[model samples]
Target: MALPEDMLHFVWKYRLYCTQGLHTDSGKSVVVLETGIHNHDAGPDFVAARIRIDGTEWVGNVEIHVNSSDWNKHGHQYDRAYNNVVLHVVYEHDGVITRQDGTVPETLELKSLIPVHVLSRYEELMRGLHWIPCERLIRTVPTLNRSQWLSRLLIERFEHRVTAIFDLLTRQRGNWEETCYIWLARSFGFKVNAQAFEQLARSLPQVVLGKYKGRAMAIEALFFGQAGMLENVVFNDTYPRELQREYRYLRKLHGLSPMDVSAWKYMRTRPGNFPTLRIAQFAALCLRSTRLFSAIIDTEAVNALKNWFEDLPIASYWYEHYRFDGVARPHSVQLGKRSIDMLLINTIAGILFAYGKYIGNETYIYRAITLLENLKAEDNAIIRRFSALGVQAGQAAESQALLQMKTYYCDKRKCLDCGMGLQLIKKQ
Candidate 1:
């Protein structure tokens, strides 16, 4: 059976192929020196490779293919970029590849050199249908290996999340505080109303709300009004009615347009997690902090950071009601520790890491990782599933990594690319 081209790259990268009497298709003795850096970008499979072809030290790129004909099929023969390719490594050498300048590159056939077990193992992983490709074999991998993989995954997750933050920052003209505010607002919506909350934030910039820094009522009015939650609703209660009046004045003054009220979701949502309650809590946060991003950066302790999101001094009306015009019923409007941790994991860490990368400060990046390490692991379906499979995440850091692994690697079945998958397949 034919194997994936990536398997050939993996075999070459790890030197899993046998080296006894290795020779190119043209009968030139091949001695492997450095395998070179694996290129993820365009141009070559591996770059800066140091290979001695029959006592001729050639230091250049190496291209891998399942069949040698793929080079011409991929049009690298016509491209001038492939002229620097020192060696063409392929599983099967069928056709001769010549560069545009009539210089035929040396080719190494890996079919016989690669161990049969390695190919079998890779095939098994590719064909297996399990929770993960190596679900049954995962326990064989050492805890140290798993931890190392998770650490890499954590960084991957952070980088992936930071890409979005950087894009938003660019749109915000590199305003970190504005980006933080918008990101935090999205996190407050949890998953259900995240887009809606982001829309509200984009509609009303943080600087506009910054004007009413210390005033809780004014901030709530602007948030609720811009969210379109306060429109076309008659309230028997005094607070929402007052919010409506305040928002009308603020809306006209700021010349702002409110998002459609339909954007906010309430069905199947808990009372505390309702968009109304979250908006109130978010407004309270705005009322409490002036420079939110700076506060996040300056705070050292995890508890101190948690305090920013916990027990926000929201309007008294929110404590009694989850929505506008609702009757008073005592409920905890305060964010639970878990909710606070979610915000820390999703919102705070990302912003910190993105800022670190933006300003080229490793301190914020270190601080971001440290914050996740200090927090407890989140209890979600993804974390729970990994825990059930004997991979327990002890901290938010590990959980975050596991979440990323599950989504990007496991779900996509990119087993050959995963560390755990690599380890499991390599095991005898």
Candidate 2:
């Protein structure tokens, strides 16, 4: 099998090849000092690398490739970014490379230096057809290393969420509360109707809902009306009929239009998880607090947050109805414990971390992690698969890390970038 250039990068990055008796392709003796920092941006592969060639010290950037000709093949020969390259490293030195400045940098080839076992292990992982690339070999990695990697992946997941939250905040004109409202509303839809709920929130801004403050019926009217659920539909129940009337008045007053009712999903969905019930539950959540973001920031205890969602005063009409046209057997309309935990995990924790980053407060970040630690691990296909492989997640934090690792690393075949894969590929 042909090796990817990334394998060469991995080998160089981790010093997997023999470092003794190194030399350039031109026969000049080479000595490694600092490998420098790996650059992920648009620049050299590695920056500020320090090395000595023929007893002379040089410090600059370093570029890696699978073949020496890749330099010219990638047009780096004409790009000024390669002009300051102090060394050119390749797995196979197939051709001579010249910089744009007409200078030939020293080149080092790793074909004869890298361990055969390392290549074998990498090939094995690359050929893996298991749940994860290194699933068969993951048990070889120490538990401590796996835990440490999970911790790192958890932070990575938080950072990824923070990036999204910050982008939303930018669009919301730095209004944290509005962003929180939009995100929380989306979370209410879970995975099935998240986009539709987000559109509803965007169509009817939080300020529109805020005016209704203490009035439950008005808030539900705004939420259900803006969702387009009340449009062109006759409700047999008095509550929805009243909501329809209330929404008509509010709609004209605010000059607001409703989203397409088709935006919501119902097929294969549980009656309890219906969008109508979620909308009603969200209205109740709104009634519990005037400001969503402030509530997230002020609430300290995990149980308190859970209780806040659990104790929401969902209207009696919703207790016996899942939709406007139909009534189901009476059931608790308030969000269940698992549902509340999911909300905390996806909505509250991410915003808390993002807010902490925005305000440079470590307390909120710590609090976010603490909240996840207190929640049960999410039961999902991904978590179950990892458990079958003996990689159990005891809390939401670890489950979230597993989710991130699966989506970003396992599914993408980024084994070279994963700590567990690295451990499995590197010989002891």
Candidate 3:
């Protein structure tokens, strides 16, 4: 019978030792340097580590798991990285694992030594809850310690995001400014219309806008034209006519083809979140700030950047019109404090990772992590759902892990490979 996974995680996480002598299936005595879950890129779930095989004590990492079969389940048996694995530890020994070089890796099974109470508590924690997981224990968890833990988790989370951004950078040939612009443009869609925004950016090159960067009218025309928002629009208004003229001038200046405005989608969005409004707001920010990317990178005072972002408002004409043909309604284009914070966090992470890659400064990477930890956890529906399950948002390592789970695993449905899920079944 399969044990509950959470219990397994708690046992692995806490490293509960069993009374049985640690030994490989070949009958060689194994000395364990660590009994906790082994960190592997891909392999068995866990490894029973040994310091020495025969008279020679091994001095490297080991992998572990709940079953010997997991080695094949995760395809570690065929991977060369597992060749250095000193010993394979599992909850049950059902099969053997061999390294790529044809050496049969030593194995150990750990079915005993874990206490029932520990598993019980872990299970209870995983079950449904009213307020916070371990609400009774929350007040007792030291504030300073909790804060430090949270900081660590937040930095880890930020590093995770930066890794993805770096991959995108690699794909884009390390054009940091262009990549940033793409991200900024995509983010403006606010989850509801990301693909559409990305399409708009791809259809209209940032190079075109760069040419007219000094003039706000020229910039606005470039934005509106590329967005396909200017098709068949006849307006007597001063701002509309001016934009129309500017668009025509830019098309002629760049020898650009007309965009397919019909490709844009606006079915599910409110007027405030329409692509046109977002693009206009983006244009306004670009107009007001000439050296936006440099300003972000060199900014020493976080508050200054916060102030600058907060002050940015959408163009005056956008406040009334979601589209050129739609009835006008008043709306402001200013970035919220939360939005600014996210941008700062992402920008800092990207710059730090980039700098680290260029200069070999691990300190920059650590500092980037520190900045993320200092901020509050991201607010979103998934986080709120977790929060409702007694997993209150706070400064704990677990909370940080929860946040990461919400952001990465839950959103992506990678639960089968998650640490949390592994822990959930360890006890049974």
- Which window of 10 residues has the lowest lDDT sum in candidate 3? 130-139
What does candidate 1's lDDT look like per residue over 1-428, in tens digits?
A: 66678877888898888877889999999998989899988988999999999999989999999999999899998888889999999999998889867799999998888777777777777775787777777777899999999999999999999999999999999888899989999998999999999999899888898898788778989999999988888888888888999999999999999999999898899888999888988888888986799899999899899888877888887777887777667989988888999999999999999999988999999999999999999998878877878889899999999999889998888887899988876676
What local lDDT does model 2 show for residue 88? 95
Between prediction 2 and prediction 3, which has the larger lDDT? 2
Candidate 2 steric clashes: 0
The sequence of per-residue lDDT tens digits that candidate 2 reaches over residues 1-428 is: 44688888788888998999999999999988988899989878999999999999999999998889989888998999999999999988998879999999889998999888898899888875787888888777899999999999999999999998899899999999999999898899999999998898899887877788889988888989999988898768788899999999999999999999999999999999999889888888888775988887889988888877887888888777887767678888878888988999998999999999899999999999999999999999989999998899999999999999999999999999999988887855
Model 2 misplaced stretches (Cα beyond 4 Å) = 76-83, 100-103
Better of 1 and 2 by lDDT: 2
lDDT score, candidate 3, position 406? 56
